[model samples]
Structures are given as structure tokens and as C-alpha cells.
Target: METLFGILNNCVYGILALLALWGAYCVILVWRRVGQVRFADEEDQDEFLSELEQALEMNNYGAVSELCEDDRRALPQLALYAVNNRNIGYAKLRRRVAERFQQDVLSDVEHRLSWVGTVIKSAPMIGLLGTVMGMMGAFANLSSGDKVDTVQMASDIQFALITTALGLAIAVPLVLSTASINIRIRKMEDLVGVGMSRLFEALKFAEA
Candidate 1:
């Protein structure tokens, strides 16, 4: 029984280790998002258009270089759609561009970030299971009609609390990360709106 509690303590250590890994992942998510949000912001879009202008004027590909530097994954292609369909009226061009982004790019960002929410919601349930099992262990050890080992009951209680703590540790930042992702998603959606506006205006000028 002594060796068993020791091993269970080690198991708790493993759970805590997983919690640490999740915390690290949240840090990574924030880091990656710093750049992504920059691109998503409509205010930050001038650099892309400026480069595209340079690309057109000098007949070089440096605008492509700027986008690649910022990890602006889909801007170049979307810009191309606007350029190519400039004569079609911006409305049509805008619709086509929105269809592509909604179907593939934005949807992909949403799907990838959704894991944060899933983990946050599930961790507490896992912790509840741990507490229930720990109670069962404590009751089983109470078999004797004489007296229960206070030390054993305390150990079980500790395990229950520790597991619950670890679960919340995993869950809290996951919720924060999901909120950050939602902000980025909205920013990107707004960028798409701006792109459609530009596409339409350019087409209207061409028609005139």
C-alpha cells in the first residue's frame, strides 16, 4: 500500500507535467498570433498594398517578399483576385474573394483554434472523475471496523485537490487562448470587408 501511494503521487506528477506543456502551448499561441493579428488589422494593410504597388511599378516581386516576411499567407492571392477581376465590377470580384477566404483560410484558423475551447471544457470533467475515484479509494481503505488510517485519507484528499488544480491550470489559459483567437478571427473578418470595398471601388472606376 505504501508503494502504491508513492506511485500514485508520481502519476499526479505526470498530470502536472501535462499541465505545464499546455501552458507552454498557450505561450506559443500568443506568439504566433502576434504576427497574425498584425496582418488581420485593417490598419496594418498599407504595407501589403504599398508592396503590391512597388511590384507593379518596378516590375519586381518585392511585394511578395514583404508578405512572405510577415507570414501573410493569403493576402497575395486575394490581391490577385482583385487585380484580375478589376473590370468585372468590384461586387463580383468581392464575392469570389470572400468565397475563397471563408471556405479555406478563415475557416482553417477557426478550426485550429477550436481545440483550446475543447480542452478548457473537458479538463474539469476529468478532474471530477479523479476526485470521485479518490473518494472511492478512501472508502475502500476504511474496511476495518476499528479505525481508518488518517494519513491514508489525507493522502487521498491531497490527490483529489491536486488533480482538480491541475485540471484548472490546463483549462484557464485554454479559455484565454480561445478568446484571443476570436479577436484575431474578427480582425481578419474585418480585413476581408475592407478588401471587398477596395475591389468594388476599383471596378467602379474602371467602368467609369
Candidate 2:
């Protein structure tokens, strides 16, 4: 029975470790993704927009396409889409661009963020389970016989406390990271909004 309890406790620790790793991985991926899709600095954004607007003002659709073609940033990708479908009226183009950005870029980020949230919520519960199991094992050892092994009991109690701490440890950082990532996500959305407005204005004139 003691051996079984020990195995169960080990399994719980293993699970907690896995959860911590998975959560960290998700957070890092989201961070990188946000960076990729958004401008890193205002200067870079300004430069890119200036070039794009110049291309548009000159009625140079091919240059506009070339400008956006190789860039992975969200704004450029959307610009490429607009240039490709330039004959579509501005209103339709605007609507479709909004939809495409939401569906393609934002939705994928949101999906990954949801996984991080799941980890945040699950880690604590799993830790509590480990704590409960540890306590039960400790009490079971005590009641099994008058000859209680102090060392074994101490180990069980330690396991309980450690699991509780570890669970909180996993969750706390993720909570903070998730908050920061959310801010970045919002910033990306705002940047995209501003960029799109500029792009559309240029497109309106270019199309005319």
C-alpha cells in the first residue's frame, strides 16, 4: 500500500512537470507569433508604410505587390491581399480584409492562448489532487500500525507541501505571462487597425 501511494505521488509530480513545460512552450510560441505578426518598432512600421503609400500613390500595383510579397508581417500580408484584389470596390475590400485578419491571424493566436489558459486552470487542480493523495498516504501510514516510521511520514508530508507549492509555482508565472501576452495581442490589433486604415486610403486613390 505504501509503495502504491509512492508511485501515485511520483506520477502526480510527473504530470505537474509536464504541465509546466507545456504551458511555457505555449507562452513562448504566442510571444514569438505576436512579434512576427506585428511591427517591432514604430520606425519600422513608419518606413514600411511610407514605401507602401509611395507605391500606391504612383499607381504602381506591381511594386505594391512586390513590397508585400515576401514580408510576413500581418499588415503586409493584408496589403498583398488588397493589391491582388484591387478591382474589388474599396468597401468590399475593407470588409474582406477585416474578416481575413480576424480569421487567419487573430484566431490562431487566440486558439494557442486558450491552451495556455487551460494549463493555468488545470495545474492547480492537479496539484491539489497530489496534495490530497499525499495527506491520505500519510494518514494511512499512521493508522496502519503502532510502529510508525517517522521518516516515511515526514517524506509524505513533504511531498504534499511540495506538490502544492509546485502547482502554484506553475500557475503564477503563466498567469503573469498570459497577462503580458494579452497586452501584446491588443497592441498588435491596434497597430493592424491603424495600418489598415492607411493602406485602404492609399488603395482608394490608387484604384481610382
Candidate 3:
């Protein structure tokens, strides 16, 4: 429609829509880091769990710390509890300490990635609102007659079209970002599960 075309011509709305896409690039970088995050292999996880139990019963917090991969080691919660609470039962300590550990890792990686989903879902809707506002401007600009208010009408039409196009542009990438973020989250869950199970089991073995 002529109305739609005229609204998009001004291009101001389009520029704003384009900027919304920057969130997608940010998502991609975050996803890449999520992928880089380390997790123990399942068998290694089980073995480590077994060893961890041994270490705990032996009262060796240092060995427990050494068993953790580097990124995991950075989690202060991982070793701090065992080091601080020498009197705590090994099984209880394992449960509390490892749960905190998993939560910390999730917060660092997968939880942070969730913000991308929020941005992705919101950006397009923002663009759409801009489009609607633009269209309203178009209708308001016209005089009662078909003899148009040409100047204001063109500006209004540009805003409407650019915003709709921009909304779609932002949305497509946002959808992609959401998908990527979700995948990273799943990976984090899987990895953390292995680690936690091992940590708990190792403590159980130490008790037995």
C-alpha cells in the first residue's frame, strides 16, 4: 500500500531496528564461550566421583581441588567449604558443596546465556511498536481530502515500513540467538549433571 511505502521512506525507524540486531552478535559470542566450557566425560566423571570419595574420607581438600578442571577450580565454592569445615561429615559436605558448585557454574555460563533469549524475544516486538506508531503518524498526517499532505505523509510512511522491516530483521537473528543460547544451556546442564553426580558419589564411597 502507498501508506506503508511512504512511512518507511524516512529511514529513521530502520536505523533503530538495525541497531537492535547487535544483541544477536553478542549472543553468538556468548554461545561460543558456552561451547568452550569444560565438563568431565561420563566415565571420567564416575571415576572422579569415586576418587573424590576417597579424598574426602582421607580429609584431603587439596586432592579434591586438584581433581577439578581449571574453569571449575575458579569456583571458590568448589574447595572453600571442604577447606573451611574440617568437622563436617563427608557425605553432607559433598551434597552441600557440590550443589553450590553446580549452581555457580550454571550461573556463570548457562544462566548468563538466558539474557540473550530475553533480548531476542523483545527486540522484534519493540520494532513492531515503532512501526505501528509510524503508521498512526501517516494516518494523522493526511488531510480529509485525497489531495495529500505530501511531505509529512512521506516521512510517516517511511517510519512505518522501515520499522516493520526492521522488526523482522531483528526478530530473525534474535530467534537464532535464542536457539543458540538454549543449546548452550542444555550443554551446561548435561555437563554439570555429570560433575555433581560424581562429586556426590565419591562422597558416598568415602562413607561406605
* lDDT, each prediction: 0.63, 0.91, 0.60
Q: Which stretches of candidate 2 lie over 4 Å from their true place?
A: none
Error of 3 at 13 (Å): 3.7
Error of 3 at 138 (Å): 2.2
lDDT for each residue of candidate 2 in 2-43, tens digit (9 for 90 to 100): 879978998999999999999999999999999999998667
Q: Residue-wise lDDT of candidate 3 within 63-167, one digit each (tens)? A: 766664343432223544544553587777767776775565556555545565566666667677767777777786674466677787777667667666776
Off by over 4 Å in 1: 1-34, 37-42, 50-73, 85-92
Model 2's TM-score against the true structure? 0.96
RMSD of 2: 1.1
> Residue 29's C-alpha lDDT in candidate 1?
67
Backbone steric clashes in candidate 1, count = 1
- How many angstroms is residue 46 displaced in model 2 relative to the true structure, after the best TM-score fit? 1.4
- Report clash pairs, candidate 2: none
Better of 1 and 3 by TM-score: 1
Summing lDDT over every window of 10 consecutive residues in candidate 3, give the lowest-scoring window: 68-77
Q: Model 1, residue 58: what's the lDDT? A: 54
